[model samples]
Structure formats: C-alpha cells, structure tokens
Target: MAAIHLPRTIRIGGGVLDELPEVLAAAGLSRPLIVTDAWMQSSGLLARVEALLGGAGIAARAFTGVVPDPTVTSIDAGCAVLAEGEHDCVIGLGGGSPIDSAKMIAVRRDRTIPELKAPHQEDSPGLPIIAIPTTAGTGSEATRFTVITDAETDEKMLCAGLAYLPLIALVDYELTLSKPPRLTADTGIDSLVHAVEAYVSKRANPFADSMALSAMRLIWPNLPRACADPQDRSARAALMLGALQAGIAFSNSSVALVHGMSRPIGAHFHVSHGLSNAMLMPAITQWSAPAALPRYAQCARAMGLADDSEADQSAVGALVEALHRINADLAVPSPRAYGIERERWEALIPLMAQQALGSGSPANNPRLAEAGEIEALYRQVWH
Candidate 1:
C-alpha cells in the first residue's frame, strides 16, 4: 500500500501573498495570530502582511519573537500570544524558525504545561495554520515535522505528526528576492538533500519518488543562478517550487542519513540546519551509495549528470562528485573550517551518534547505520 499526503491548498507565484485574506476567509477563519521573527518584523514584512489582511477586513495580532532554531521556550511564548489574542487561525510568516514555532504553537494552544508537548500527543484542532515561507529551505511550510530546541538541554526535539502540516501553504518567490547569497545557497542545498533523502528512504513509494525527482530537476539547475543574482525571479520561483515539492516528498516518505546525522550537529554546535546538512552531505551519500545504487542513479540523471545508459554505480559516483562541486562552488565549509574545536567534536561523537540513532530516522535509510558506523561518518567529516 502507498500513502501520500499534502496540504489541502497551496498558492504559488510572485505575488501570492495578496491572496492571504481570500484564502483565510474561504477557510472560515477570521482572527489570525501572525508568527514571525524579529528580523522580518523589523524589515516591515510583518506590517505589510498586516496591512494586506486589514485591507481584506481580517484582524490579526503579531508575535515576532521566534529565533533561529526555535526553542521550546519560544513556542511557549508564541502560544501565550495566541491565547491572549484569542486567534482563530495562525499565519506563519517567515522562514523555518517562525513556521516551526507556529506549528508548535498550534499544537500547544490548549495544553497547560509546555513540557508535555510530544509528537504523539493529540491536540484538539486548536487553530488552522497558513504557512507563508520567505526562504526556500527547510520546507517547514509543507511538512509535518517541526524541530524545536530543548532550551535547558540544548537538544533539538524533532517532533512530527499529521497535525503539524499546514492547512494552507502560500509560497511567493518575491519574498525571497532579498535573500543573501549564503542563505540562498545553503537553503537550496537543504532542499536538494530533502529530495535526495526522500528518494533513497526505505519508506519511499512511487508517488514520493516522482515528486522527489521533479524537485531535484527544478532545484539543481536554478540554485547557482539564484545565488549569483538574488533578483532572478524565475530562478527564485523554480527553487521555491522545488522546495515545496521536496517538503511534500519527505513529509510523506522520510529523510534519511543526511538529516539524521545533521540534527545533532545543529543542536550541539549551534550550526544552521541547512549548512550542517551541506557539511555532512557528501560523506553520508558516499557511505550509503552502495546500498541504493539504482535510486541514486536516478538522482544523478535528474541532476543532469548521467543518462539511462550509464552504469548505476558510476552514475551514483557522479552524483556524489556533483554534490561536492556544489559545496565547493557555494563555499560550504567543513566543521573544522566552520570553527568547531577538534577535540570537543571528537568528545561528543559518541553522544551525537546515540542521539542520531534515537531519532528513529537512521532506520529509515536504505542502508541503516549502526552506532559505530554513524560515529565513523562523523569522524570522516571532521576535516
């Protein structure tokens, strides 16, 4: 049996943010809590959204405190805002942090204690959520996963369930026009990893495979152009659409080795999620390639590195080389180069390996890694 799920409504284009009021009204939501970050708030994007909502006669309250790598404390704060405002819906209006924070807010709205938030816990439909993504990475707008930090432990909690998927997703490429080159590159690579991991996951089905392949084709070619010129609307649009598709693919299927290994680095070292993924991507792919040759070959073809006539192993090798090239071209740095202390990184290897295993993601990989193997891969990336 094959199961594929996606958001009920997705609006995409250059100016689709204008459809917010109509979209919300059609869904029977009136009052909305706008979840965003201080940067977007300071940049006036939040106010612009408010103005657009006001013009369409929808009332909204803004909570602009979500930080990067959203912590449980941040979610708690946003939920407080939602409660006081008595919002009927939530509008997540920034990148992954705000969107992930908003998802948790929706889940925690009725809960009294914040610590009780778990992936498996059920919440009464608190409020409908509309995810409006400003960046093309993380794909939190389309996925059911929301990574929240345990502030006390400094560990990332990868909570996921059906409830986290947005009721609607509004993807406007225009919003990403101002994204700097580093962010564009990192996030674009993150999207690529999502598609690649989904395609090679044990849970992958025919439906997700199609989406994953299409997403790779869309993202691989346009990422460099978008990075070089942030104002390239067409490239930006392609990347955004690719990211959305990759989110749906991974949401229904799963993300394998790269994501499983990437989270702990983010939690322990405070590295950005996409950059961590990029740092570990080449090594992880090389490690897992022997297990899923045909699928990796398809990925190579999608990235335009090979064709049907090429040997599967050769094509997979090409894919890995291409990823390394992308990393070098985009200036993706190694952990050592990114400034993690060598001794400290080695000390945490065992704990990070255990945490990665505990997340239940490595088991979904086409070739599952034992603790020792996962530890070795971490060491391999040290340089």
Candidate 2:
C-alpha cells in the first residue's frame, strides 16, 4: 500500500497572508520564529509580517540568515537563533531556501548533519512550521523534503521524512506577483520538472499520479505567461497552485534522475536549485524518455504538447524537443555556457557522480544508471 502525507491545513488565495494571526490562534501557537532570507527582510516583508503579528498582540522574532542553496552552516546559525527564543513554532516565509532552513532548524537536536542524510528517514515531528511561500517553486511548503549543502564537502544532502513537512501552508499568489522574469522562469521550470520526474518515478502511485498530471496541466501553459508578464494575476495564481500540486506530487512519488543529478550542480557550481534543474532538464529528459516512452507520452499529452492520436514514440520525441525548446526560450544555460570552467567540471564528474548515486534519488528512475553512465551524463550536459 502506498503511504500519503500532507499538511494539516492549507489556506490558498490572494491576501490569505493577512490571516496569519488567525492561523496561529487556530493552531494554539503564540510565539513564532520567522525564518527568511536577507531579501525578505530588506524588502520590508518581514517588518510587515511582524507588524501584523504585533497588532494581534503576538510578538514574533525573525531569523533572516537563510541563503540560496541552504547550507549546514546556515541551518546551525538559524537553530542557534531558535534556541534564544520562546518560539513555539516556525514561520518559513520565503522561497525554498528559507523554508528548508526552517524545517532543518526545527528538527535539529544536536545531531550531526551526516546522521540526517537520506537512507535514514526522520519521521518524528519537530516544531510546527507555518509555511508562507513567496515563490511559485520548490514547493517546499507542500513537501516532506529538505536539501542542504555541506559547505566543506560540497555535497547536497537530501533529507527526508514527515519532520520536514510543514504543519500548515499559506499559499498566497499575491506574494509571487512581484517576482522578476528570470526567477519566474527558473522556478516555473523547476515545478514542471517536479511534476515530470514524479510522474515517471518508480515510486509513483495512483494518488501521486493524479497530482502530477493536474500540476502539469496548470503549470505547462501558465509558466510562459507568468514569466512574460509577472503582473498577470491569473498566471501567477495558476503557477502558485500548480507549484503546490507539484510539491505534493513529488513529495509522495519522489523525484528521480533530474533531481539527483541537479543537486550536485547546485552544490559545486553555486547555481540556484531551480536554475540548475533547468540546465539539466533537457539532456536528462532526452536520456530517460527512452525507457519510459508511454509514461513520457502521457506527460506530453498532459502538458498539451501532444494528443491522443499521436503514437507514444513520436509523443516522447515531441516531449524531449519541447523540453529543449523551453530551455532555449527561457534562456537556461548549459554548465559550460553558465561558465563553469571546463577543466573543473571534468575533474568533478567522478565525485559528482558518486554524490548523485549516494543521494538515492537516481534509483527511483525508470532506468537506473551506474556511476560511469552518470559521469557521462554530466559530460553530456557541459555543453
């Protein structure tokens, strides 16, 4: 039997962010430590949230030390802040990095970072997390996963289980309305990869399949629109909802090769998680589609890139081409083009492959690859 998990409460819409006090009261939580990035603080959103809480007679402290591709060091820093407060819950109030930092911070209990890595599931709950996602990507709000990089080793640790999942998600499309075009494109593509990878994952079940298909339908069309015009409320709303669905989808079914391989790129190259995923998508899709033609074709049809009349083979081909075209249209750069020195990239291929294998995500692919094959894929993606 397939297992399923989700947040206890999810509030979605425009201006739902204003109901944070009510949500806190409903959960019987008074004090919260808001986990966010420097941008959120500088943009004055942190102050606005604090004011809202203060107006409701609740004083909240915020930790704004989160960074992109959150590291073990950052998590420790946030946890140190968590220790200084009587905070009963955590408010994750930014993109994936802050939310992930919040999740890791809540669960850390003097345990070493290596102890939490994949193959060791952390099912026990930690401090309640109230996720207020400011972007339409990563789906960290709806997920049971957190990715943190080991700064020294350059390994992106994939930590799993129920503890990483949020207790509540406040999905406000309004929060994403002001996102710039590049961030919009990268995160949008990241959500699409979540749906695609989950749909084809070996762990996929009926429940996850439903969510993945629905996410593809919403995301595939709206992504471009949202990227082209950030002010398009409908597109932004659709993308936000689509990202949540994709998060739920992958959370249940898991992500495969694209995610496994992409993490290493993020760790070594310092690329944003979503942008790294975008760079790897086209090549990986072309590589993996052959082993799951019918499944890939279904994804194509769901994304409106193909129709029922088309054969699976042709549909899969169309899907690969569309992925490449989307990357081109979105201006996603190859690792080489993104300016990773060729010698450094070649030198790390073996270690990156080893790290990718250790992540355990590649095993979920329909067609698994050995270290050598993964090394080759890394080579193929350089240009």
The CA lDDT at 163 in model 1 is: 74
Q: List the residue pairs that clash in candidate 2.
A: none
Which stretches of candidate 1 lie above 4 Å from their native place?
110-124
lDDT of candidate 1 over 165-195, digit per residue (tens): 8999999999999899999998999999999
Backbone Cα, N, C clashes tallied per candidate: 0, 0
Weakest lDDT window of 10 consecutive positions for candidate 1:
112-121
Provide C-alpha RMSD values for all models, in order: 1.5, 0.8
How much is the lDDT of residue 168 in candidate 1?
A: 96
TM-score of 2: 0.99
Q: Assess the local accuracy of residue 354 in candidate 1 as a C-alpha lDDT between 0 and 100.
A: 86
Give me the displacement of residue 267 in model 1, in angstroms.
Answer: 1.0
